[model samples]
Target chain A: MTIIPFPARSPRRYGDLVVTQPMALEDEADDVRSLAERLVAGEEAALEAVYDRWSPLVHTYALRALADPHDAEDVTQQVFVAAWRSRHTLTPSPSALPAWLIGIARHKVADVRAARARDADRLAAVVSLPGAHELHQSADEDVAEQLVVRQAVDEMPDPRRTILFLAFWEEHSHAEIAERVGLPLGTVKSHLRRGLITLHRQLEGVRHESR
Target chain B: MSHAEPDQLAGLALDPDDASEAVREHAQTCPECAALVAAFTGTRRRAGADALVAPPAHVRDRVLADVRAPAPPTAPPPVVVRERRGVPAWLAAVAAALALVAGIGLGRIGTGETPAPEASDPTPVETDDGGEVVAATALTALDSDAERGEASVTDRDDVITLRVRARDLGDEDGFHEVWLINVDGKRMVGVGILADGDDGEFKVPRHLIDDGYRIVDISVEPDDGDPTHSGVSLARGELA
Candidate 1:
């Protein structure tokens, strides 16, 4: 079977959380595009709309990047406030606002780290922070792309969804998955191939979108 | 752009070292393909790399207040065109036009009537090249409301094919088979056996559809020499 765990996963399922609704990612893409348009058109309420939909994402991402919860919250606030202030000039695609916000988040994160490094006392505090020195610029860049990916996978329908979960998260071999899911080995391989392609398209779509 | 196919890009991303020489050469030469390969590499690395955490609610109130409170009053706000998600301006015109004619308006004709031709398949990840979907149905597990998979009837040229996608049907000692049962419930035709994965295509005769065999079923059949349906259905659906 050609179902090699593409990125070489951790061989661990995050949690057995139940997905109550299986949504169409296309519908979501359309909705996000509209929200982006609204934000660009200077709708103040649209910012709240954007927040209701994605505040948690930005907050969690910021929190992950900055060791301090308060720093993360500050970054999240700056990112949205900056997005609103620059609404007139912003031209990110409908499917791309998340990526754009992420772009802003990255900058805010860098600024926070930079400011901390510039001050010796704060630098001492930073040195004492948990896993602060372990942070790398490359992993920070990957935050948005990873969130987009996890969202797409969660939104994926069954069979393919379950198959991908097994291969990536659970690190199951084709033979093991075939036996476990009672599918033919070939079908599992096909599912993986198709699922991977769909994911590539989603990622490409976000990157290539001009507005 | 002289870009490669999605399958090839995916193949390269999935196993870059194993990619063909031609794919590698093209990727090296074409900027778009190279970028896509890079993007795919990133995608793979990012897919489920970590679980996301939602922030607490107190942050929401603070973030909202910070943006609106600090208003620079010196420069007046620019004239902004608001585009809300509510009813469109043209919708009012269309409604008025519909009211004028006591009958159905021409504008109302194609609004919800026809499914548009797609530039590409958005989801479902299935690879069916050119066959047009004639009829489709969702299969549910037998004796329960749980969805199993979907089946679609497609017509390419003059041939009609039945595509069944079954999921998590659970392993049984007996084989899982596909069948088309007529409405009367007595008459049925054994179409084909379901393979593993999501899709199974069985080319059915044209007359069978016209004869009212609209019910698609996947049943568990025993290894016993009985040529009949084992009477235990794993999943079934009606193609409307």
Candidate 2:
């Protein structure tokens, strides 16, 4: 529930671009570095700290990837256990722990999918089902898309970021967001519109970069 | 609604109920507008799907129990250090020359292989007199919570080769730069950028080692166009 903040000073402008400093994300980075250090030092409590911070994302990703609650729960446990085992080999940086956990999640998800695929192939041979492959493919794509969107939102600047989270994560209406955040309804609408546009552009850029 | 402005399109994408009838009509007919709306809606839908779910308490209990359990005996026995005094002068010179070549080759090859296994099983370099002269130690995390590493310093001929394998030093915005700080803490020598792995081998300048620069420090350097250390040390270990 850390509130990410944009730098308070004047927004620095380049040619035609204005760059807002990411103070909140930077603070989160500092926190991550500290947590990673503790985990590396063989402190058992640090393991819990990491789990508390990242288990939600890990679980959500696994749920989307595996498309089963039980599988997601299993993957979540596996990811944390693997992370603990390999704590000694982790890089001491803020992004390192999250990145490492995500990496492990990706691998675990892949393994689950592979296992499911083998099962599906065997079942399909005995009793053919149409659109099975298409369904699986779309589900995988959905998980990847969700991951990208989550990352973009995580990096977004203040009001827009908070507004988007309120609207989507908290399922708040514009009026509710205004009331909760103490902003004018008009301002909330404007911010939501602008935030959506920014998120769309960021997602597009990610797609291109990955390609 | 002639052509939806970026914000208008974003609004339409976010919620059709909030949009004007005219905007909704235009989106239905205009493929471009429709695509934009679809993309926005899809992104919003997926982002919303990541609602936080607290993992079951039993899972936590299980993880804690597993982690708390004593680690299995998998690692090899620790290397024992032995000192030998009667080394022939010619053998020392030959070893130094071979080390110099190996160090240069490592640089040319670049870092790609895994460093973890090699660190645990350090290859013994034989001198002309069949004596081993490798000095190594476990590098402890400095400011980080869990970063740990190992460093091995060997004298081949007169070339001082330093090999390091560090783990859990998470990714950073800037690069991880390795340095050999003098024991006196006044002077430091820049080794090189630590690659995206746990291992790196550098040919240390003889003068640096001779001058007592034995502390290995890894600092995160911001990409702010600064070449100097940002004074943010992530991990540190002294070469024995």
Candidate 3:
């Protein structure tokens, strides 16, 4: 598994947005390439390792795109199965596996949307339909935002990461998080403040870099 | 109203209940502060959304199983040969022994009323004994639940044992059950009920762990007479 190195600097203001450097993209790409090579070689354990590393990301993308947990789960399954079946076709290089997986995910998501549209059309013949193009664009944007946030969270340091996960992912109150993690309330509050700034900065930096 | 600092805006975004009147008024009037608040709120909302969930363990299992299924004769044979060559005989034997032990342990736990023996030293300190630590993971909270824990799998003379340490798991009306779930999530073996303390150990069948039952799950099961999982998992971690 690829270990992501944390950034050294604190969050810095970039005009209206606070910004920090995101994780090393180059290292991440290399990690993906290595995993894909092992997978393509038919190493069964590689499949499990890849799933452990990327399932959360894939599941999150599907959930955001489909807006239904069941559909998201189905799409996520389809994506991995398709990727594994077509592993031979993928280039054994950095970014290939993730790109291939994401491509498969996009198709699965599109299929779900099309199916839903057809069902809606049949159910209500007179209902005005929204533009599929707009929907797809928005879904892509949402997944992109989620990816940025996930990367930011994944890159956070220990206690901060745990605290932020409890706050944002678990939606726990400050007091609840402190009690659960056995930290003082004031410390939890401080971590929350710093963590949010770091996350915001990381998100802005990713958006900026992608642009 | 004065402008709110980023931290104040973040606090407001995380919990409106924590918002002071000054922060609310500042956010209402200051566009920058409002945008900051909106950004924080958006990140928090997205994080809490179901997107962060892992796919049911079975999905990976099924996908891999399908991929590994025998292909038509026309397919290349090198892949199969490579897979066969990858496993050493010694490792395979060890894996098989672990599976057998796990199976026996499950039966003992299921039928017997006695709790699985607790290690006098709860820490995963490696002993000079033949048992070795195979894998470990820090259990993370799922579905915004506040449970936190760690789990380790040990290979003791071909028998596999699971040691778990959990915290912040407040009293549940139902009992807490530990399970070694297959990657596909379709198959699971009940290791044992979690003791009311911070640390506990359960013997796991090697087959359960070897056959893709790598996810360690601790769930709150209602005493509803049903033996199956209540689906109210408090903490889960996949073995590395």
Q: Score residue B86 of candidate 1 by CA lDDT.
A: 42
True contacts kept of 1: 0.30
Q: What is the DockQ of each candidate?
A: 0.13, 0.20, 0.14
Given the true complex, what DockQ would model 3 score? 0.14
lDDT of 2 by residue, A100-208 (tens): 7766877788788768767776655533767765676567556655765676576578877888899978889889999988989888988988877776775665444
Report the error of model 2 at residue B125, Å.
Answer: 30
RMSD of 1: 26.9
lDDT tens string, model 2, B1-240? 467877887888877788888888998999898888998886677776554566777878887787666443342111111112243554344323322322321212112121222342233232344223455546656533354676666666566677777777777777887877654323456798877576777887766765556667777777665444555566765554
Residue-wise C-alpha lDDT for candidate 3, range B1-240, written one tens digit per residue: 567888888888876777888898889888999999998877665564333567888777777776676443333322231112234444344333333323332322211122223431233434345566666656656544344777877776777778888777668787788877654323566788886675678888776766766667787877766555554567765665
Q: List the residue pairs that clash in candidate 1.
A: A33-A94, B165-B198
CA error at residue B124 for candidate 3, angstroms? 69
Residue ranges of candidate 2 with Cα displaced over 4 Å: A1-30, A33-44, A64-69, A87-100, A113-138, A144-162, A169-182, A189-211, B1-42, B70-240
lDDT of 1 by residue, B93-150 (tens): 4322322221211122121122322321222224356766655567776556687887
Q: Which candidate wins on DockQ?
A: 2
**lDDT for each candidate structure:** 0.64, 0.64, 0.64
